[model samples]
Target chain A: MEIITSSKAMQERALQLKKQGYSIGFAPTMGFLHEGHLKLVTQSLQENDVSVMSIFVNPLQFGPNEDFEAYPRDVERDKKLAENAGVNILFLPERTEIYPNEPSFEINVKNRTGVLCGRSRPGHFNGVATILIKLFNIILPDHVYFGMKDAQQVAVVDSLIKDFNFPIELIPVETEREEDGLARSSRNVYLSDEERSQAPHLYKGLQKGSEAIKKGEVNPSSVIHIIENYIKTNTNGKIDYIEILSFPNLDTLEQIHGKIIIALAVKFSKARLIDNIILEIHS
Target chain B: MEIITSSKAMQERALQLKKQGYSIGFAPTMGFLHEGHLKLVTQSLQENDVSVMSIFVNPLQFGPNEDFEAYPRDVERDKKLAENAGVNILFLPERTEIYPNEPSFEINVKNRTGVLCGRSRPGHFNGVATILIKLFNIILPDHVYFGMKDAQQVAVVDSLIKDFNFPIELIPVETEREEDGLARSSRNVYLSDEERSQAPHLYKGLQKGSEAIKKGEVNPSSVIHIIENYIKTNTNGKIDYIEILSFPNLDTLEQIHGKIIIALAVKFSKARLIDNIILEIHS
Candidate 1:
């Protein structure tokens, strides 16, 4: 596996591969590879002639108070895991290379970012959208993979590609979870042992929300109440928000109809974990 | 010449041409074609195997108080002008097509946009940056051409392409001038015959500033004063702004040591005119 560091070199490599008539698949990650991230790489490998995985711990995405300074990183371990997971090229750009100076131009995400994780962390989606667009321009992939664990992010990317006319396909893979239904994330490393045990309830709460919709709980408020109550009684974690909104668009619904997502963010002793489930209503 | 109205069709055409190893050169315009705009198209035709011109008339770049509704456009005449200039593809997308709805993501330009025309027209460059990025993604051009008449715009594009890692060359063509030394602009049509003659003074003033720099005037204030006085005396025009700053970065300079620009915008009774001259100061 080739490990490319410089943005210019990586861009040239992607361009060279493109000119050779190879369909490139890309998976952009923030280092600290887990089974969940590997799922995206697996999907990319299956879909394209070449798969490129980028492990850039972008500072732009983290708030001043957030885990930017303490974010986990293990490039040596990640390199081996990526190689085993079939990443043909592993781009690991340094902070200086990605941002020689403060970016003069920025991507301001408007819709689909006001709820869920977006409300908790302002400018987070803007940072994500900005870096992803830079990576898309550099890699010039035919298809880019994203784990649906970050559902709002996937929606933002969809809107970005469509609005800006980026000629790339978005492959949204389903969220990968643990045996206890805890959605795998790098931040899982921050959880204490006791906090880790309670983390599974976040996903379980989403499942209950989904089940509530399936059981003909047509009202969005009542459905949200059920899930909010589930998390409140079952876990010691503090509920940040429990929202039921239209998927992708993320507009508040008068009543649940068509496709909707039940998403939540819970803060345990050490880590904040988020999860969601999409439910489609058939007319 | 092929006229493409649909964004999808234009993207596909660009992709097809790129796959067939044709180098595409792009020129994005807002219709009402003039000699200055055609110069860019001519440069694109000379440089690349295929030349593409897009007449978008982007409303995003126009402020609420700006001349968005009153902005001149002539598609029929522009089509002929583009075809005559050897354009292989002319993309003319309607407002609804370019923007299916309000854009979910916006490109905000920060640097090189706080002076001169940018100060007078805020959010103007953001709109320009956004549409240009969309057009670049759609056209996938090897080279994109812009007129140096809008020197600050060329500077902003330089920073954008560098900051975003856009894999395309920016060809900044010199400003095209009339026999009377007036910079060619579609807005020149709004100028009365007297204003038309006086418009040439803007360029002449910039020329005087450039000559002062050549004559070893290291002081910015003195150089600006020379140009300002020249314009004030030579034409009955209202000075909007007269600034001497670092080239491209547009940063304020204490001492003139490196490459710099003396730029100004002057309003006549009927139209506003702008001009600038870049000078490299040798120690």
Candidate 2:
């Protein structure tokens, strides 16, 4: 596989490959390869003539107090994992390569960024949106893969593509999970031995909430209480927020109708883990 | 020449043409074609295998109280002019076609939008930036043309292309003007006969400023005063603003040691006219 570190080189290579009639599939990520990221790479490889993986631990997406400096990075391990997943090209741009200077304009995400993890991490989605746009312009991929694990991000990207009329298609993959039902995440390394065991309860609470909604719990508050109580009683963790809102839009829903997402973030001793489940309500 | 009114059909046509190895050159404009718009179209035709023109009087660029409804539009005339200029495809998407829903995200231009016409008209460049991005995504042109008559816009677009790393090249064509030096503009139609006679002074002031700077005037304020005074005394027009700043960045300049732009706007009885000249300074 070819490894590209320069943004100009990546763009030029993309254009040449495109001219040769290749349908490029792109998977953009921060380094430290996990099962979830590998799943996206695997899908890209299956769907396109060429699969390109980009590993950028974007500084713009991290707030001043966030874990930008300590974000796990293993370029060597990521390179092997990506090649094993059948990636044709590996784009590893430095911060300067991505941003030659401080950007004069920003892609401000005005909607769907105020809920879930976005509430706690301000300017995070703006950074994500901006970097992805830059990547899209550089890659010119036929299809871009995004995991539903970052479901809010997926929603924001959906609005971006629709609003901006990007030619590329967005393929959202399902969240990969552990054997114990905990959603697979790189942050799983941040958990202590006790926190690791309690991580499974986060998903359990979401499952219980899903079961209640399926069993005719219509009021949003009553359903939220059941899930909140599950996490509070079963896990030694603090509930950051447990929210039930219209899927993707995150708009307030008075009743169980249309699509809805039950999402929550839990703060353990060493890590903050988030999980969610989407449901279709007809009643 | 093919005329496409549907945005989807236009995008699909552009893609098919591109896949057939045709290089597209795009010239986006508001209709009521003037010499300036024709110059951009002419350049696009000369540069690429296919020249595509889009005539959209974007409401997003006009303020709520501005001349959106009264903005001059002549599609029949514009169609003839574009074909005469060798345009292959003409995209004429209506406001509803371009914007099916109100955009959830806006491309706010924080840098160059605060000066010249942008100083008086807020959210104007943001609208221009937003619409151009959409058009670029749809057209996917290899090169896009813009007339430098609106110099600040050229600068804003410069930053946008660089910041976003758009694969398309920006070709800024020189401002096309009449023999009397009044820049060709559709708004020129709004000027009364008497007001039209006084309009040439706007470009004259730009010339006077350029001459003064070339004759060793290092102070920006002195050059600005020379132009502002000339416009105020020679024409029965109200001076909107006369200012000098670094080219593109629009940053405050303490001394004339680099590329600088002397730009001005004068509001006549029925129309507002703007002009500028870029100067390179030494010592």
Those runs of model 1 whose alpha carbons end farther than 4 Å from true positions after fitting are none
Question: In lDDT terms, which candidate is top?
Answer: 1
In the predicted model 1, the residue pairs found to clash are none
Report fnat for all candidates as fractions from 0 to 1: 0.89, 0.88
Expressed as tens digits, the lDDT of each residue in A1-283 for candidate 1 is 9999999999999888877788999999998999999999998989999999999999999999888888888989999999999899999999998999999987889989889999999999999998988999999999999998889999999999999999999999999999999999999999988788878988888888888888888888898888888888888899999999998889999888898888888987667888889889874
> Which whole-number lDDT from 0 to 100 does residue A195 have in model 2?
85
TM-score versus the correct structure, for each prediction: 0.98, 0.98
lDDT of 1: 0.90
Q: Best DockQ goes to which candidate? A: 1
Error of 2 at B185 (Å): 0.6
For residues B4-65, could you state the per-residue lDDT of candidate 1 as single tens digits?
A: 99999999999989888789999999999989888998888889999999999899999897
TM-score of chain A of each: 0.98, 0.98
Report the lDDT of model 2 for residue A200.
95
- Compared with the true structure, all predictions reach lDDT values of 0.90, 0.89
